[model samples]
Target chain A: MAEEMKVIYERPRSWANKVTHYCPGCTHGVAHRLVAELVDEMGLLDKTIAVWPVGCAVLGYEYFTFDSVEAAHGRAPAMATGIKVTNPDNFVFTYQGDGDLASIGMAEIVHAAARGWPITVIFINNGNYGMTGGQMAPTTLLGQKTTTSPLGRTPQTNGFPIRVAEMLAQLDGPAYIARVSLDSPVNIRKAKSAMRKAFNAQVRGIGFSMVECLSTCPTNWKLTPVESMERIRKEVMPYFPLGEFKVAQGVL
Target chain B: MSDKVLMKGAEALAEGAIQAGCRFYFGYPITPQNETPEYMSRRLPEVGGRFVQAESEVASINMVYGAACAGVRVMTSSSSPGISLMQEGISYISGSNVPCVVMNAMRGGPGLGNIAPAQADYFQAVKGGGNGDYKRIVLAPSSIQEGVDLFVDAFELADKYRMVVMVIVDGLIGQMMEPVEFKTKVDVSTLKTPEWATVGRHGRDHANVITSLTLDAAGLEKWNLKLQAKYAQVERSESRIEEYQMDDADYAIIAYGTMARIAKTTVRVARAKGIKLGLLRPITVWPFPAKQLQAYAPKLKGALTVELAYRQLFEDVQLALCGKIPLGWFGRGGGVVPGPQEILAAFEEQFGKGR
Candidate 1:
């Protein structure tokens, strides 16, 4: 009898391994896997509660092995803040994209951080909007062509991309803030680690924690899935650098 | 069994929450329902409670969302514009399935219409104000007494169903004070909150998730169906209506919350004028008493709806009547109240033939 070979990079049983509704080559699948991995690694499979955003990955709840909720546009942080505060025992995280986090939800995110609510926020900073037909996001890079930005982003009119990690790093309440990209395996590892660290900080009774992942959107970027991965490394990384933007020393 | 206190329709609602062991109150100051948070601010602090006057309407509702997640009894008050601003947060709470009481002291509006009483926000209160498919259990208070009664009912329904309960009142009803008594005192704080409450993760094994997102069309469908079931259950179990004089009358009026109060006064005046009018006031508009109203539809001549708006709830009365019964309406905007006499005139014009 021939020896059976172990499976390669297939769905992890702990992740429910169901087919995701994502368009080909979307990095949200990768980000979601990393989170499910951490939930399993930390033995939070049954206990983890995730708040999903109202963007491309809105059905993020279906891809996971744990409990999830869909928040209104720009209100993931507020909803997660509620879940974390009310059910302080659960592992709470909000998976939000650029438009949901930076554009409409600016008020909720700022105040949740300012109040030092103990929670974790996973912000996926793709350059343009994804779910609502690729409108320009607050994090849209200069000269990025999107449905809303037909002539590329104009600094004179649309303003520059927002560095959310940098902006949030200055806040006194946020316990951890890291910005990482999902361009390659090595960076994906770093992004995954950043997410674990932020969640672990909240688990330790630390204050608001966030990990900003520079993700990819092939459909919106008008690139193939392969090219989408390539752009993250070749173009996107050059603009949004990878690093640990903030950490509350001795707190975690 | 607690001591009785004289209160306004609005104060009765606030005191009812207090008596029910409510502990958190967050809201923006709008006219009409200002007494709710004002009473909560002073009263909550005295009884180990928390009251926060939020920076804006948005902040206040979100703050309630935050506190409720922590397993506390939380609520907020707002008028029309402020309530509209709170739609985002209210949607969040509904999606999350976090229970909290939202008091809408409705005034006239499309845009800051008036400070006069109006029930124009019928669509907003019943339909999930924010995006996504959901509904709130809208409790309409018809009297100074029912104002207090609905708060207790709201907390019960909010907790029972694990959804947002709107104690929708109008300006005139909220601002007016009257004597009311609790037939029975309920120890609201003693009622055990669900294990899902996120008070603290310490020494716990379960991590609860309270959210409204269902990423896939199928997954979203599952959640929506579940919500519909809950709403159906609410409709079957919690819907309420008050029938003041439907025994021999040909026409009945269908109104709720503050509109019902003005409607009642209109009913009395219209009746005295030899119009055999009876009031069919709905206490809860969301799980609307459609079945009850439909029973009277075949026999009714017409229905008069006295709301605080021009076009707000006229449609609902029409919907309940289902084109089988003709519907008439009367009202004002902002906080301008509908005079009982004006409503009576509209009633006479619309249904005078029956008399």
Candidate 2:
């Protein structure tokens, strides 16, 4: 008996053939690959500009094969707004982390969404501040222990984790908003679907679209890669409910 | 012949930027400079340009940063506190070598001192306000007409050097009305967009990456040295100063911006009293006219550096003269404008041999 097999899956043409700087047990690599694959599928490599954030992705331009610019801490949304407004024909998006977008950049992202800016935002919500030594971030769970919250986050001291997708969906301007997680194969496939939908909304000239990915930082969370994925499924998924919150009336 | 139009300093500067081919403006409303964004909002749309009233000053400067990297002439105007908020973004822009124009309609400071006219931010303007070894091509305009002219020149200088160019004026100039002549307009077609701009991948073979993070120490050093070389060239080629009635004079007053206007009056009163006095007004403060001042150092008995802040500009004058000529300083602060009589009295107290 003879068997024949064909190779179908490979790296996207939009991604540079190089190693990432993210630590082991980190899901940023997966997020990056998904973006590259989607951008390649949509053929947006030639007319896309990515705004990098000040967190671990400060050197993100090195991994992407498209035009990119680095923004100061918490300023990516503002920079993205300007780029989209000035170059409306090009595809523009901002890659930001919870600390960069939710903590210091709250105003920038909120206003950009409210203005109905035609751009995409890929918000990575990894409960802890992974870049700065496992510090407490705006998305940290209620009882999660971080460097800044050593005694474990208490309601009296640290407030509840921010539900970004829900908050942004409340704004009347966004065309599509969804929260997804990368905890398991089933969730990951769903995450890709949500991302693809968000990118499609942007391509169709729909107003601001955002995809919030619940990612895992095992090293920072002090867990194995397997355990971290389980944590995202059990702990982070409950508070940050997944699914589409706002799909513009006609944008589906 | 050109027509003279009566306009506020803010509006004149806005019109001048348009003539200079500036196509994008991002600003937040602040006193003494609110009219600038207002003027741009109404005029930019007519010319196919863009304007955005940003969420905050921090957001506005970052917007300018993005537009600048996209290969467009952009600007943002603010006051003292707002400019302070923009320092971090300005540092990023300077480090990336993105060409843009920023105008600071300075009001009283040291912490929201007042809304009145003051030169308290002279040090923050000429020196590097943000972290890094960088300098802004600071232009100080004493009159509304001069502000318009300087605004036009700022765009060219920023493009040619690929750095931030600043026009620092007091609240008085921003709010006051004066007749200004619009005689010149730089050809927008002649301006070159560098190969590094992120205007898409149509013409270039590779994607452009605009960033300031040089993680390697040696790499960062090389960039800093390149910036220093450009600054050296600017110093040699762009130093500008106006010397008034310096012929056969013994006492000279070194001033700039609104202080220069007051010093002009001081020169008149001192000369009327039979004292040989003159004025040296610096138009470009960063590439300071130190060479011109040095040329007159031997001829003058002494010099008085006048400013709204206490001894801020005096530090620069001293550095330029380096003790070869004795320098005296006098001024008022916290939005207080020194009177001509008060300045004349200070000049006599310091340089007067009989008094």
Quality of candidate 1's docking, in CAPRI categories?
Answer: incorrect
Model 2, A112-205: lDDT tens digits are: 8898888899999998788889899999999899999999898899988898999999999899999999888888888888888888777888
Task: Show the colliding residue pairs in model 2.
Answer: none
What tens digits encode model 2's per-residue C-alpha lDDT throughout B22-44? 88999999998899999999999
| Model 1 lDDT tens row, A161-197 | 9888898888998989999988888989888888888
Residue B337 in model 2: shift from native, Å? 0.5
- On DockQ, the leading prediction is 2
Error of 1 at B48 (Å): 6.4
